[model samples]
Target: MFNRLRCGSGLIQETVPRFGFGPGQENLFVHKFTFSTSKRLDRDKSLIYNSQNKPLPRLDPSVVGTGNRKRAQPVIQPSEKFNYSVRKALELIYYEEESRIPTLFPAGLKLSRYLKSRTLPLEIDLVSRAVLYNTRQSKLEKIHLQRWAPVDFDKNCAFSYLVARTPAEYAVLVTIFREISRLEPNFKPRTLFDHGSGLCTGYWAANTVFGKLTEMFCVDPSTDMNDLATNIIQQGVQNVPLPKGINFRLKAPKTISLKYDLCLSAYTLMEVKGSLERLDIVHSLWERLEEGGCMVLVEQGTNAGFQIISEARDFLLRLCEADERDGIVDNEKKGEVLAPCPHNHPCPRYHHDTVPCNFSVKYSLFDIPYFSTEDVHNDLFSYIVIKKGRREGFRFPRLVEEPLKTKNNFYCRLCTGSGMLQEVMCNKKHKDLFHLSKFLHWGDEMPVHLEYTDGKEKPRPVIDRSERSMSSGEHFRDSKKEKDFKEEKDSKEEKDSKEEKDSKEEKDSIVKNGI
Candidate 1:
């Protein structure tokens, strides 16, 4: 005995007892049901069986997706920050004078050329060997000893730097600080230590990223530079008071009484006369960093700049290891690399590749006199962030290059946690991973797990340059293939023209014959 229940455009056949039953008696016996639909249901509709004919829960529209797959989200890249302080400083100093505007262009060019040609001072021991080898003379020349001259940051030089370099420096610092903020949302620094703080760019950038700070200690050796920075802080026009808890000094304090939550050294190490002095400065900065604080170091994107950053990274790591071994520092408080690297092992790029690992940020150019030819420019920089704590357990692979999106798959060159550079591919077959790959950018961490074997790492495969171009969504053809294509196209055009001419001639003949 069966009963037919009417549903929307469907029939449900249910098994029940032959006798009429009351509401409570319906559940006394076991019942079986089969449902059939005359037409297909819409995607938004769902059919559910209910013996009591009660109302059902509504579905959430937001959770619905195409084929139930997760939707792809947009990737967040480094953003440009409008430097109001720099703009105000420039306007107050130059006063929009037409005469002063034209002079800025030449000064900027001269400053750019000088900074690019600058190099570290040569060692005294190397000076003697080089003189003997080059001049073939027994005695070293005094000229060789006097070759290295330190840069003098006079008023003119300071003005030139503020015009040519401040915007780029601010942009780089902002990018680094934003990265730290994004990765560690709870990081709020109470005090900042800006080493070699030229024009106090670090303070401005930090303020932009982390709001107000309790104290900022800035140290620089140039009195003119310090004065310029102070003037900029005061905005020159209205004699605005300096920000609270901000201090400037011509040299660092001798005692280590104060520890800061954030320490920054940007484009400063390269100015040191020797490597030993740079190391000493790095160690001192590390000492001043409070426990669990972060230390940031940034340099130019050149190979020399990369070398400087790497040296600092290695020296700090070695120092931490030595301290732990000597029972001076606990394992829990050891310093670790925080960004642009996924592992504490030696950098693969430093040991294996000739090219340096660097990233670029596009920043808006200041509206200075004669300097606004391009509205935006790219600032290439190398930076390393070190935090004083044990390394986190979960680490992600960093994309070393811009991801390539082909028609079939996405390719990414990654620096894995295993200390190897690998090229990985993601396709539609990998549902979630493919969706995630679409949002990846260079210098971003990939949220995927990788397994490693216990043996030696494998070598990277040698890929042809042409193939790489094609993989990057570029259509490239060999010379022979291009020549053949051209020939075929020409022949087809010739044949079509000849046939048109023949048809016209035949029609003319027919008209002449009067057929």
Candidate 2:
């Protein structure tokens, strides 16, 4: 969604310059542009028109999509702390090495001699061919879907997951490794906790740029990803010496108390949905890091984070537009007021301040070269690095168990013990009735409502709940009681019926012989 504000006749455009390219270079004039809340740019004021010295009609930024379109504006800014750290590191490398060199990692098990025998061409060819035959879009494609090859147990394809890895992903990982290596030269990261380490492409990137870290903790819940990571680490990897005493823990929860030297999380946090859980994850990472440890986060700028900020802004703008057009305030409009400062320290945006989540998200990015000579651009991904602050001093305001109740949000008529109506019914009475029927739509399945002790009805017995796992003792007791009850009832009924039948037969025989 895009927010279009009505400016007087013309719109304001912000132009940002590209760095590290010569004027003659086609990539030199990379445009870092973003759409304004106002109208289209003044045709006369825009740089392209000025450079060409030609009169052009007014154009809206919305019309420009790709190639010949204006670029997105930079939303993030690099702070002094971040800028200084990057600059000092670059200076140190220049003074010490006299040239930029990629950082090396600990040798686990060197398979270079074996890797040379297998060229990159061979690996890529195999990956492409296999993917062609196994892709979801291909009608003829068929997947064996076997973790282990049937023909040979020992022979495994390390490139299985890499076959599906995307180009954007590859680019992001490479960029991260390059930047981290530039920052810390001798920082041979011993413990790598790769959260959501999808496929082995990340491991491949790590191996290529940083060599073999002492022990790579490839953390991912996907069985396919885990298999691929294991295969890549154990198979014919070049120059990466597998650590003899290294530990590999997969799928299960990690209980090791050891802190990581460098933690790399790419495309991890964007998947976090719940606000509370997201904050917890960040805090957990902070706690896991050793003092002065480095954490590098790379996400799809196009898909996540501030990328969604645009959508949120557009939503608010539309809400306002609807209200103005209708001349009546919609219920939603009341909550659409923007915070005074979107990026305030301990920001109120997304309720970060009150939540246990803590991170100084700095907005910054570099101008990357596009394939065309005329176009230089910013890749949406921004790199964020935070050094763990003093643990004792880093106390956030105590997390309120629940958000403060206010009058404006307090009167939620729909949820006020009323089932989508004007009348208030005991929610407890309705809850059980609702649970008994499968006809009601509750998302993809019937809604399960447990009896609430204080709800409109008395709490149900503990055993009535379906979720309670029956213990062995309870199971035996239940079966024994049921069997005994059945046996006693059957015996009593059988005895009474038999006695009545005997008396009737005796009376019938005497009557027949009376004649």
Candidate 3:
């Protein structure tokens, strides 16, 4: 017989009463209990058994490994060398707004006014005037006046330029030099020759990129500029001394006997009076380049600046052609365009009137009183790098415009190796290429192969390889050669027509005779 029994949560117990027959007699009872294990213990045992027996579901190989993933291509950026040097130089020179406020204020104002004048649109009167001659013949004559004059950099102007323009110039130069280094990693220049080296910005940029040079020759016509450059190199104190193997001259060397591994002429062409003078300067700089050396030319990014750079590019190319023709330079040592262009052909945008082939670099501005309040600014510049040796290796198309990204695709405007501008579209279907293209920016090289999506390639421009010459303030072709060429072509055409007519007449006679 069983009495009432109860079980607790952790343990189970049971009690039984004996002898229910006795009416008022108390019965003895026995209880039995046992401890129970928790459910967590059972779960741990099952997990261990399952883990040892069952294998993990095979992971999708593609999602489980990093080896199959594509790494991002690094973007080319402007170096901070110039910015760092500028801040350091300013510190070394003890540049303070409060100390030189009086001197800098007027100079800054003058410089601003001068720069504004330079940027003003140049106007020329083309109205013709009729003049009566004694011989009763009236002739129409047009008078043209010069609209702008070059700024003469005095001590104050030089100082102003150093404070305001040097950082931007240095940024542009460093960008260019870094590009060269990227393209030609083995290139190391021992000597540098910088013409019109305002404040020695080229020197500083080159030194930063290539490290210490064996010799640096800086030529500037402005004595004030030269002094300012030397003072800066001396760190604002005469006792500090100039850097080793660096020399500043008020004028370029008269002879080209001494050549340099690198030659630079930045913003100097715009200062010259005429195209011929700029050409002369470019020629001189080209001559100063050693064999297998590189020459860099830079100017403002304005249309005029672009024209100046284009002219220099063309002139240098022409020189290379002439040298090759005359057997002055070997095929391996001939000059070639190194940057911003994939071909030696004429520039694609050269004929375009409104558009100029220019590039911009972002740079930080130094803190100067009465100057720009912005910390960062863009320097728009037109430049060309010419190497004395033939360009080697694969040529990649350059991105001329900023890449436009859409939800599923991106567009790029590229200056191709065929010397043509092309717009290309890359979509998600391209997979990795589309992802890589997103990192590309303006003035960067597109590594992917380009093809016409419509299956029709654009025609290349036809440039006449005629014997051209630069003349007095103009570019001209020899009239005799043009006349002879035209005559020869006309004669060939006439002869071909006559022969065809004779053959047709013969056929007609034979038909009549047969009839």
Lowest-lDDT window of 10 residues in candidate 3?
38-47
lDDT of 1 by residue, 1-515 (tens): 23445689796655332232234543233222311111111211011111222211121233223442223322222223334444566677746532464676568658765554444466567665665565534334334333335778887777777766777787888878887886677789989999999888888788788987889999999998898888767666566666799999888998887999999999888888778999999999999999989999998776667778988999999999999999999989999998888888998766644456888766655654465635666667889999988655466778876666666676666787778666566777766666666666667777666543333455444445443434222334454677899999999999999999999999999999996
lDDT of 2 by residue, 1-107 (tens): 01123389874333222122222432223222332211112211111201111111121223222322122222232223322332343343223321311111011
The lDDT values for all models are 0.70, 0.37, 0.67
**Global CA lDDT of candidate 3, please?**
0.67
**Model 3: per-residue Cα lDDT over 154-252, one tens digit each:** 866776676666767878888899889978888999899998888888887887888978899998889878876776666555566567889888788
Candidate 3: residue 236 Cα off by (Å): 2.4
Please list the residue runs of candidate 1 whose C-alpha ends up more than 4 Å from where it truly belongs after superposition: 1-83, 91-99, 117-120, 134-149, 237-241, 367-374, 391-393, 452-515
State the weakest 10-residue window (summed lDDT) of model 1: 36-45
What's each prediction's TM-score? 0.68, 0.32, 0.65
In the predicted model 3, the residue pairs found to clash are none
Cα misplacement distance, residue 52 of candidate 3 (Å) = 66
Off by over 4 Å in 2: 1-161, 164-167, 236-256, 307-380, 389-515
Q: After aligning candidate 1 to the native by TM-score, how far in Å is the CA of 462 from where it should be?
A: 13
> How many angstroms is residue 315 displaced in model 3 relative to the true structure, after the best TM-score fit?
0.9
